[model samples]
Target: MTTTRDKLEMVLARLAARAEDERVFMGLYPEAARAAADAADDRRLAGVSLGPLDGMLVSIKDLFDVAGEVTTAGSIVLRDAPPAAKDAAIVSRLRQAGAVILGKTGMVEFAFSGLGLNPNYGTPGNAVDPARIPGGSSSGAGVSVAEGTSEIAIGSDTGGSVRIPAAFNGVVGFKPTARRVPLDGAFPLAPSLDSIGPLARNVQHCALADAVMAGEEPHILDPYPLAGLRIGVPRGRLFAETEGMVEIAFEKTLGLLGRTGARIVDHDIDDLLRAMREATLHASIAAIEAAEIHADWLTTRAEDIDPRVHHWLVRSSAVPAHIYLRMMRRRRSLIEAMDRRLAVVDVLALPTTAITAPLMAPLEADEVLYNDADRLILRNTQMANQFDLTSVSLPLPHCERPVGLMLVARHGSDRRLLEIAAGIEALLAS
Candidate 1:
């Protein structure tokens, strides 16, 4: 769909001027289109393409610094964090790939909740069902890709931020190994747990976007048979907490994989849970880092932030050093345990979230219920972060509340993990 004459610019204009009656799901900033088009023209004339993703539009989560714009992170706190001297590293990578920086997509406030509620900017409406929650922190990122607002979106996953929205919105979102992408200029929710990932139309699209974002050579592979692939199913335990419908969906999905020649074996969720407790990646670990980041603002702009986020920030400041240290030690031990287990398994598969997306309106009204649901949303996905596993969440179909299958590989096996996930996606589709 590209022509030699400023193709990127043409798309930018078409997207920018598109009717507002179009979609409230994701927001776009196509103002950079002209410059992107010039860069595209320059690359074409030089007789070389940036990469496979040249001249495409990308939506960024609001948490990252986008040069000259505010890094809201779905909150009003950092309205003045010095309008990013330059784009976040990922944004720079997108530009390098000849991808147009479409705009800053929406997110959960302070990247705290799983439900995509933006009291100030207004939540990014879910395209699937108006009555259903869009899923958050990476809320808008998922909707952006699903609604065609942008082909791909870059979002952070502190606690299921990226994957939750993808599952809710019926798209693909992958949380790469923690350190795969540089977090230099991205805002932090929980430093140790915070990760940057992609929300795109499909697994391949996420792979493409991740390559550009991580500044690594892209690995594009066709789907392969699952036989000889040692897939681990943490059968009894992880499956224990799942609901009836969730259990049915999980079995059906596993059945599909079995039929496709994949070897499903036994695994225990205890490994992940153990790491999460040790790493303190949850309430204590995440809270402390966040408290440090917002130390100054918490006092100065305490009243400015949303009350829900303010509540979390206030509680975050109370995590003591002794607890934090012990947790770190625990983290190392858990990682070692995971490494040993993963060495034998080709991939570890689990549901992305324990439950499906909740209703938006009810969650909006009750803060207590909202917090409980947020933890429920974060249950399965956070374990990957605790162990620093490279994980990809794939949306599964034929279910009422859509669930995601998360496949994780030990520390930096992102490329291999993506390939494996692609196979599972193909099997499910078939």
Candidate 2:
């Protein structure tokens, strides 16, 4: 029988052994974590454990404010920033649920890129293949869980930050509706699109963590029946750049679901595809908003910001006000369009990433290569964010490496999405 302290010590030893390699945790609160574990053990002994997450070790992304610790958000610029005065809302909720937060994990600088290449703190390697890039901006968050340093990783997803890393590292990642989880203390990326979610071993773990973070009671999940489930696969641009292996994995999963009496429909989402493309032609709500939040720093301390992040921020200042306003108006129209299109289907399905994790060397060496890779990784996942949908990425079975099959639901459909994902997960495992 493993005690809470025993689990903590084993994880600590694993972290220590890898300390000399690529960085994963940006800050480790060993003393605090051990103390918290002791308390959880005491509660367990007294038969009064807090809840589902009592004694579970978790890692928060650097974007979250842990009281008394400066949030670096995977950047060097905020290292000297003042410590947080209070815990971020989710952190407080996690504490209330008796979750022991082990530390802060590294991330993409200012949560900018899908490729988690952090020059400031070394990027955490993919658990499947150390030489490939770990997806980001929640890069370390995914790696921490995948490598067994933590049971769950708390990360923010503006443009697939949580799901991308989860896909790369062979874990489950959930992105609830944008407004479902409060983002008060999280560092802003695109305020309109940023959402907090979990990277964990399975759908149930994500559900439990999400419930805690949302300030609700954690509940057991009953998997939805796969029979008669309506799953729509977008036909056009969604498949344009998909890699051979990803396509095979995805098609195979769809076939398996279909064999179990699932209704698989191909959707011609040309309007949705157009909306996504138009979003790129104008001011990115994420880039412009991120630029606004970091303007002062970019103006005075540009030297401290990551060049890739700085490149986008500096470019954002040139976007005309009229274009930004037009984009914002179009955003509402598109969200409505997506909702109507998805009304008939229980969920939309696609490969979480167009390509598998790429090697870091070429992307880092060339700006063009980096931007292209970033776009590919962010493409499919960004739709859910832009359309205000709830989504989850589940690892497909028997892939030589990890490949994620993403399932998306209409806005505010988080609970249903999770139940649906739970069903898919169970079906895949069988």
Candidate 3:
């Protein structure tokens, strides 16, 4: 039997072999991990098992607070912040479940950008191709899982932070309904929309980690039967501007599902999306809320913040309070409308991202390209947050580059979504 210590040593060796500049992790907890691994191994020797996650190698995003360490949230500005007195709620739960936390993974500064570029800590490259961007703000989480350094990686999904990187890196990422998992110690980008989730090599692992973090009893996911499954594809605007490769992969996956007796139909919510776009024309809820969170920093430490993030926050700060409130009120009604529309379908499916990971050089050197890519990359995934839904991104097979087929369901349907994803995952693999 492979001992937990054996797995820990292997992961440590792989991380050590990487160049220092690769920057998949912001920090590593080798000593603590080793101790945890030893404990797990001893328990196994005594014929005791904690659960499915026991002894699993997991990585956490930098935004999650670890006791006695500063939660940087991928920015240099927060380096001087006081150390956390206690672990984030999820961290504590993961430990209780016997997960050996390898380290804190890298993310976009303050979890702001979807392109995953962090000027402070270096961005980890795509797991498949080193030259391509790793989607963010859960950039490192996706890469860690894909590269085999971590079995499961925890990330915050405010606007596709978890799913985007998973899509780009060819891994599974699940974003539960907001507030499903406690966010007590996580540094927030947008508290209202922020959700704690996991990225892993498969749907089962993602489901396991999500359950542990949510303080639920982890159970084997009973895959939903594909036959007679109703899958609604919102194929109007969300499907627009998709790269040819992504579109092909998405359609191919849908075709497979259809052949398997899953019902595929066009479920148009373009009007709702358009309304959301118009409501947030001045600024998104995330941006406005983030601006409020960093208002002091924008005024005092403006020079220290990422220029791209700072610019958006600054713009968001300019929106009148009345407009922000009005937008929030309108958003609630839209959320209700979305829920009513979704009542007829089991889940809504779409391409996880509009395009695959773009090459890093152009995005780094060109501001226009960076902003455009960021917007496009975040377009599809952000809708889940806006409309209050549970979503997951499953990597589409046989693509030259990684692409994901995303499934979005009504809010608080996380378990059902996972079961559906598991069924789809099995179908795709078969």
Q: lDDT per prediction?
A: 0.77, 0.91, 0.94
Which residue pairs show collisions in model 3?
none
Q: Give the better candidate number (2 or 3) by TM-score.
A: 3
Candidate 2's error at 105, in angstroms? Answer: 0.3
Candidate with maximal TM-score = 3
Residue 8 Cα positional deviation in candidate 1, in Å, after optimal superposition: 6.7
Q: Candidate 3, residues 1-430: lDDT per residue as tens digits?
A: 8988999998888778775665999999999999999999999889899999999999999999999999999988999999999999999999999999989999999999999999878889999998999999999999999989999999999999999999999999999999999999999999889999999999999999999999999999999999999999998889878899998898889889999999999999999999999999989999999999999889789888889889999999999999999999999999999999999999999999999999999999999989999999999999999999999999999999999999999998999999999999998888
Query: Looking at model 1, which ten-residue stretch has the lowest summed lDDT?
Result: 18-27
In model 2, where is the ten-residue run with the lowest total lDDT?
A: 275-284
Model 1 lDDT, full chain set: 0.77
For candidate 3, what is the total of clashing residue pairs? 0
lDDT of 1 by residue, 1-430 (tens): 3552344455456655754543333345654655675677678778878887776667788888877776777776666567778888988888888887767777777887788887877776676776778888888788778777677888998767888898888889999888778998898888788889998878888999888788888668666558888889876545656766767787788888887677898877685675466466445566677887888888788778878877877887877777777888877887887888789888888787777777788888998888888777777777677777888889888887677787878888888788888888887787
* TM-score versus the correct structure, for each prediction: 0.91, 0.98, 0.99
- In model 3, the runs with Cα more than 4 Å from the true position are none
Q: Residue by residue across 1-430, what tens digits does model 2's lDDT show?
A: 7888889999888888877774889989899999999999999999997999999999999999988999888888989999999999999999889889989999999999999999988888888898899999999999988988999999999989999999999999999999789998999898999999999999999999999998888998999999999999997888888889999999999999999999999987777768667765855788988888898899789888889889999999788888888888888888999999999999999999999999988888999999999988998999899889999999998998899999999988888899999999999999
Error of 2 at 203 (Å): 0.4
Q: Please give the lDDT score at residue 151 for candidate 2.
A: 96
